[model samples]
Target: MKKQNIVIGVAPTKRSFLSMEEAKRQKEKFMAVIRGIHPDVVTLVDIDDICENGILFETEKITQVVEKFRRAKIDALFTPHCDFGEEQCAAGVAAAMKVPTLVWGARDERPNTDESRGRDTQCGMFACTKVMRRFGVQYSYIWNCETESEDFRNGFDSFIRVVSVIKAVKNLRIAKFGARPEPFMSVTANEGDLATKLGVTVVPISPNTVAARMDQLIGENSPRLQDYVADVKQRMDASGMKEEAVERAAAAKLAIQDLMEEKHCAAGAMECWSAVTVLGAPVCMALGELSDEGLPVSCETDVNGAVTMAMLQAVTLGKEACFLADLTIRHPQNDNAELLWHCGPFPYSLKDSSSVARLVQGQERFELKKGPITVCRFDDVDGKYYLFGGEGKGVDGPETNGTYVWFETNNWKMWEEKLMFGPYIHHVGGIYGNYKKVLREAARYLGMIFDDADEQGVYSL
Candidate 1:
């Protein structure tokens, strides 16, 4: 499936009693400041055509504004107060849309010596927020700052990422290939709760179907299989791998992609205990390539792990690939460092520049490049789902084996306690960015408890 895009309805608001010239000027400047955002990232649909001065002020124009935004298929509504805004009108539009809503006001100009202000954007924002509450419209807020200010830019980026995260989970579709191994009880989750509570759909893949597809490509020597093997050779050091094994891994990747497309799945969870029978190879490299290509697949049939990957990918706007890793062991030397490793399933694109990308025995091997990263786990107790999010940097450490990294969290002991006491497992979905705030807001909208490992101390089960 193609990555989703966010459409924001930019509806500037003002009060009739406010200085019209000043409000108009503020609206113009606000547009100029934010227009730098690319259309691909967030398509801006302004209300300039629906009302005079491109400013919203009159309650009578609410219907037209909402209709226009609906036509544009806006994923969120942004109502900026040009001056003390038309609170009632803005609230009406937000309540009608019923999507994620946000409101902000430019910092008001300094008041005159006699207490006369050029415009009271913040004062208006306060009034508008009260009306918004009365209307029962939930929304996000940006602190009162100039639209061009760095603080506002950070808030705006965060808001868009939050919207993307919500989009990722709403009606999410995950593919299930084979059953979870008996030993992997930690990855088990309730499909009934996922469907009934979260609106996520689980599509099961028949083992026979997977076997037939892989056999067709390898046994028949399909030309498509050769193309994929060539891609494998170009991307990594496949010379040490068996020729037939490399071909089998390539076949598995193509077969999985075909099935995901036909099944309309955004991600996948596949059994790995009997890798030889299920995928004809180790299957680690196959999973890695799929994630690099934008479809993350979790090993050991960890469906929630796949969900976690999709969530992290959404926050990055699909610009970075996600890795599902084992939260294996603490550093032998560094007090705060821990090893994040998997047999061979990390995306080659995430390899450190200093490390060599290699494929041997159908597994990937390389150290992931160091950077700011976020690791999160999705799980539940009973029917109450939650997202455990924590941020850290990939640090230097001894590398023993597999695709791996040494992560130095803010507090390793604290993080360990949270997992030990919570409904979490060793498998975590991670990506190369600090997205804890984005994940927190997303969990808020999803109605899931967000366990912030950095902020919250260990709690009793």
Candidate 2:
């Protein structure tokens, strides 16, 4: 999530019969809007150098626009209807780009006072949608609206997130540090399907490898290791813990991270009990630290859970980190509340300010701060892969053990039924904002079914 590394291809489309000057002016406004909307978060490469007046219309110029975007290595394509667009040309460019795509146009002005025609941006956008389907081009859309309206901005932001998910999964590489714990059959995954369908790979790393690395990292006591130990000390009250325990935890963190980095992995899953056995301490604190730094790791070697965490992290464009938690229990007093807890593996940055952070048996113990949260999972059943997402909010409940929070969904019964009746499990990836809709949109591009817990209208092409 370099944020700025996600490049987008801009296609300003219009009808050649319309005023060329008007299309040019509109293209300028659209370009400015794209640049300003999410400044520094995304890079934009447009067709201005190839298309006449920087507007897409003539069929002959489609190849040039496609080649330019291809050469730029764009992650997504955005088509703005400058006027009644050349629908076929827009479709051609998107089909050629073969990336997550977005289409939209500014609301049209009323016809001239003299009864002359004005730019029918909405009409062109409507035509483009049909051709996009005709050309097998999948895309998201912002409805006919003013370019500066909040609606347009929200849609564009959502589209960018969709692009983020698509780009991330295309190059996703998760490190499977050890086999799944024997008891957790629910966390099993189809690695072959993950590779064939989503282009995701799981790099295997045996526990023996991690143990060797941990031993070497511990013996070093290098400046970097000492700095990490000091950093952890500042994050929590380590007064009751042994200095050796903290140092061991810090080394373990560095060890797993170094291994993942060596293998070029963005996510990881580990057999936690084995890790504890090898390091003489739980790696909960280390796991939390890694997730906080944007490298999500799930305990019990939950590969699918790690994948969910990675997707949820990317959905925020790396601006926010994600957490993987167990949907363990129901609040005794609150019917809709469910406890999301792990054995002190949550990031300290998400710790509740009102609560004191402490280390308990090498586990970081603190309650997570309250906020809107989106609980998501990527799972499969009988070869059918799907993404499950639901929105909730952190709420106060009876204090619990380890690092935890209570998430209250709109409908507790509905959520329970969805998870209970299907190919889902207790492990879920939680991120701080509501990106359920964006997850649904991203699923369309990834060839996964989108399952919404709360009943909502489907917005798909």
Candidate 3:
């Protein structure tokens, strides 16, 4: 597991507590919860050494923590708000460093025996939140009333998971299987920029080298392939799909392993449609299976989706999530509900259906011969959220009433109108469900605009 270095700074002040000992107690409590959440990489800033206790006379104490963390090269700051002290100090540090900050309220929200016994206690912590706002800091707060309520408990769980993902992404290494083709513009990105900004390494390899590695992959009789086949069969049976579908699906899985090793990739995206069409096999289904197996093989070698999928994996921790689903109109009359589907197979877990997976052979994969699907995308620029998608059901006509765009920008509305006037590009999208926050942070670290509406689809460049 890659480590996430998160430094937590605590405020010192006797007012928040009756004595230095009480302040220590409060700090210990918060530290205990935070350490338990992500112990391996979490560091605590001793308020005693920084400010003499839990007292804040000047912003120097907070600044000191920021400087120390900067030296240690911390990824994020987590502050346990004891009153306003937590938010105030955290906001100050964040404003200075511009690092992500999270305000954590203790899991124990129970009132103290003497609520008014101490000055600037938990209530003071709450009051100090305004101080963070005063400093123009961006922070997330999670208040849990013990680990009893499902809501608070779940929220805390999600928060910790999200933090872990942030850490994981900052330390991840990805192999960019081949050089960017001249025709694929959106796929063009600076490798060094990805490392410096997103904390992710895009290791590039020659296509010939990838092909050699993939060619070495063993077939079905191999132990790993056998296990994969058996598992697929069992899942198919459970899913209640036809026997023929199961067999074809199993073959497709074997093909993925071959491709993975041939490409020498943990994940991949390839131009395999021509080969698949020649072999009369399901290329998209293979892509979907590789994706489900923690490796997302995108068609057209979409580097952006591969990056997005990696962040999603870190966020969902391998939950049922994929980054390609359209948010187009499902029906001409009902435009509110966006259609969510892919020309390729997405995991049934995300779709929550009992349908068996099957291979789509021939040029049918590119044909717009399907039911209504939704098109959706997420964008989070500097933590400000903006996501807009609509449902568009397929209709029998040359021109479609929907648009598939990459990023949402200032001219998105105009672009949508222009695309709507043209032939509907049979639904192109990724999974959509409040994912703006999930991908935006990743993009921020990568120094790419989260919402680039004028990018004009990748092919144009």
Total backbone collisions for each predicted model: 1, 0, 46
| Local distance difference test scores for all models | 0.86, 0.85, 0.47
**Which candidate ranks first by lDDT, i.e. highest?**
1
C-alpha-based local distance difference test score of model 2: 0.85
Model 3 per-residue lDDT tens digits across residues 1-461: 12234555543333433555655666665555555654554565654556664444355576776667677665556665444344445566768766556654444334546544433344655665677677766556655344235544455445544554566556655555455445656444455655665666655544454333333333224566457656755543324445444444455555555555554444454544434433334445555566666666555555444555555555554553454544354434333222334555454344323233333331112213233332333223333322223333333322222112122223434435533432222223444334444445444444444443333433321
Q: Tens-digit lDDT track for model 2 on 48-146?
A: 688787788899998888888888988998888988889888899998988888988988878646756689888778788998898888888888888
Task: Give the distance in Å from residue 73's predicted Cα in candidate 2 to where it truly belongs.
Answer: 0.8
Residue-level lDDT for 440 in candidate 3? 50
Residue 99 Cα positional deviation in candidate 2, in Å, after optimal superposition: 1.1
Flag the better candidate by TM-score, 2 or 3: 2
lDDT of 1 by residue, 95-142 (tens): 999888988988976874675656777888888888888988878998
Measure candidate 2: CA RMSD. 2.9
On lDDT, the stronger of 1 and 2 is 1
lDDT for position 34 in model 1: 69
Model 1 TM-score? Answer: 0.96
RMSD of 3: 8.7
